[model samples]
Target: MAEGGTTLEFTPTWVVAVVCSVIVIISLAVERLLHFAGKYLKKKDQKPLFEALQKIKEELMLLGFISLLLTVFQERINKICISENWLRNFMPCKKPSDDKDEGTTAHFQTFFSPPVLPATVGRRLLSEDSSAPTYCSIKGKVPLLSTTALHHLHIFIFVLAVVHVTFCALTILFGSIKIRQWKHWEDSAAQKNYNAEDVLQKKFTHVRDHDFIRNRFHGFGKSVAVLGWGHSFFKQFFGSVTKSDYITLRLGFVMTHCRGNPKFNFHKYMMRALEADFKKVVGISWYLWLFVVIFLLLNVAGWHTYFWIAFIPFTLLLAVGTKLEHIITQLAQEVAEKHVAVEGDLVVQPSDEHFWFNRPKLILFLIHIILFQNSFELAFFFWILVQYGFDSCIMGQVRYIIPRLVIGAFVQFLCSYSTLPLYAIVTQMGSSFKKAIFDQHIQEGLVGWARQAKKNKGLRKAANGNSAGSPPGAAAVQMTKVREEDALLRSQAKGTEIVTDQRSNSSS
Candidate 1:
């Protein structure tokens, strides 16, 4: 008990370390089990089973958070001592010591007292000799943070680890749900054009091969839509901007007002759209800011934050990775629409340049990777120095460059792992884009609103007129034309009847 009626007790670091280790091991086991179950369900074609598991995992995560909060309250008053003499002077202002032991030095106070470093042990070594200097002889040491704040830090780290894994699982589960919806649409669309009979085979074979490619990239599109990450990009390129008045009204009204050849420059529009979307690609990453705060708190109290900082950026990188996937997807759609004519095989024959690296595209890829991955690493690099005052960890190893280097390497590694397909897809797009640009057909085959609407309107009017009116001619000529069409229809019917008779006779 303190002189001012406050209680102080030492909670062992080894105990906190043990608890953290147990939580980490359990969390990993749970994650691996969930992953195993997910793969099993997927293999067995049990979507409902996987979905039910997702629901259970979500429920468990909630309970875990509740239990974590309860645990925090149970131990909120006890602070764990992790570091000594580090950041002691930088702690917030406190009242001066008024006791007989006022001049006690930090090294003596830390080593001589109960809150000794982790390696120190035994009363024989710690006990002071009567001739030697003691706690009373040295100045008092400042704390890095309030005792209460340190108590809360332990709970924060544990909860952060559990919650991070849970949220990642939730992301994967959401992706799985989207995959089901895509398959349903693909199968339904394909079923419409399927026929077993030969007579109508040509007429019923309406499904395009590129439809498979389109369905596969549906996740890429859905992710962008759900995250609102690249909606504006789609709006500009696809000529589908709803809220932009210049796009919706001015250009549209002018195109409608003049029914002639396009006065609007499609080439300029594509260039501007690309430029606009480029600006929005790497917008502010809010998760980086949250990480900075977490890291600062962890350093102040010497608490083990358990690399939860990397977790947010990992998730963010996944989201950005999903967005980058559009490079492959958009190019596939373009190829399907143009060269394939929405009917042929959905494949791009890559140019010689595509097999070897193109420096410009490589630079763009690096820019995106660095912006998404290294931005967080650099933030933590400087912030660690700010909190610790020294450029080293507790073990006296210089850490200024280690985290940045190690994290950057891991990020680069993950980028390669997560985006291998993305790289190949981007290469395909680059090849296609190069050909399109060389041929001066960058905007070729792009659907336009005004022209297509007019063409559709004309088709509808012609259909209505044909059903409502007689063929335009003298009555005799019109009758003669009708007689010719009747004769042609009779001949086709006769030919079909003869073929049916031949088939019946052969079978008999």
Candidate 2:
């Protein structure tokens, strides 16, 4: 702060980001340890550790709220830097110059003619005579920021992003191929033809079948859910909502909801569902959490360029993973509940309260797309801005270029804040369309399969119609007994008394 050409007054955001990031990092580490410990604990029948794992997961997910803020603000950081540059450029006009020549008027004209941005302003503040620099960076101003600069920045960042995406896309393709090869090496495996829709269907199917591997796969969800919840809790607690009042209101609502329904089971079901979902996505894994922390570490460790781009991937990966997890979990739960109902469990019937709120997990996936697409793109531009300073390409150009930078930053926010919500809505609606397509197939397939199974069972019963399981003559007697029993049950339900003369006399 002291050495920097211009010292910016500490913004509340700085305190929030640093403090929250550190807490999130600690939470992530603890989550990782808990997960690793739980894996071994569950195997070895260590119940206490298993329970602790569950508690940790709950907290971690609750904290993932910070991650959302982190995502929101990381993009804005470059703006702050740029703004400082803006301030520095304007500040030098106030400082009086001692080495005044008759051409001091010429010098003043030269400065005003060149730019009104930080690159030019910064050079004046830090360089003294433009020889060498002492600090990590210098403040500079150029010409007022403009349209050409904005468009140019956009084009430059977009090209870099296109390259980054291309690489990741190639990596995904290569990774998929490797997976196929690995599967082929297994017992009796053969190459299967795949359609894109079918492949997507299968991916969703894996999510659908998540519970089949729940004991193994659930850790991932539990991890994210807890982090998300915890992040939210702290944000509300320390920063905005005034903690104790919030808690009181939360509990009051919970108590009020539980007031009439003497049946706590319904309430329990809703709470459990919320916990499972929230924790699972945000809490159940530490990979992306670790990634974000590690990426920031690189920046703090002196790789200034890493900070801007890294946030994109970290945000994308978390969002995508969270969406996939939530959707699959919900679908899987639905499937399980369907089977449970078929087996005649009254308790498994859908609660009326739940029906109103039970949105499909596909919303999660949609959210990730919204988050990563814009955030990732922004990361690219931010890196470019950082590069603009480091590479010395914007000094003389700064006077011409600073206006564009400011405008672009504002545009970034406007585009993101609006586009993200719109994307979420459209994608979620699209997922609904996809679900309708899949559900039609699933309904037909299951009905047909069930019919065939029933038919096969009937055929087997007929084949053994007189087997020792029934006995030849005894089958008729058994049928007669069954008919009599049905009649008796009907009569009892109707409250009718059969008045046989002998039975009547005995009763009299």
396-484, model 1: which lDDT tens digit per residue? 23343455357655554444344332332233233333221111221222223235545555655555566546555544454555556
Q: How much lDDT does each candidate structure score?
A: 0.38, 0.35
Error of 2 at 421 (Å): 24
**Candidate 1 — which residues are off by over 4 angstroms?**
1-139, 143-150, 189-294, 297-322, 328-508
Whole-model alpha-carbon lDDT for candidate 2? 0.35
Stretches of candidate 2 off by over 4 Å are 1-158, 164-168, 171-316, 326-508
Query: In candidate 2, where is summed lDDT lowest over 10 consecutive residues?
Result: 343-352
TM-score of each: 0.29, 0.25
Compute the lDDT of residue 310 as modeled in candidate 1: 49
Residue range 209-246, candidate 2, lDDT tens digits: 33232321223356755754344333321222222222
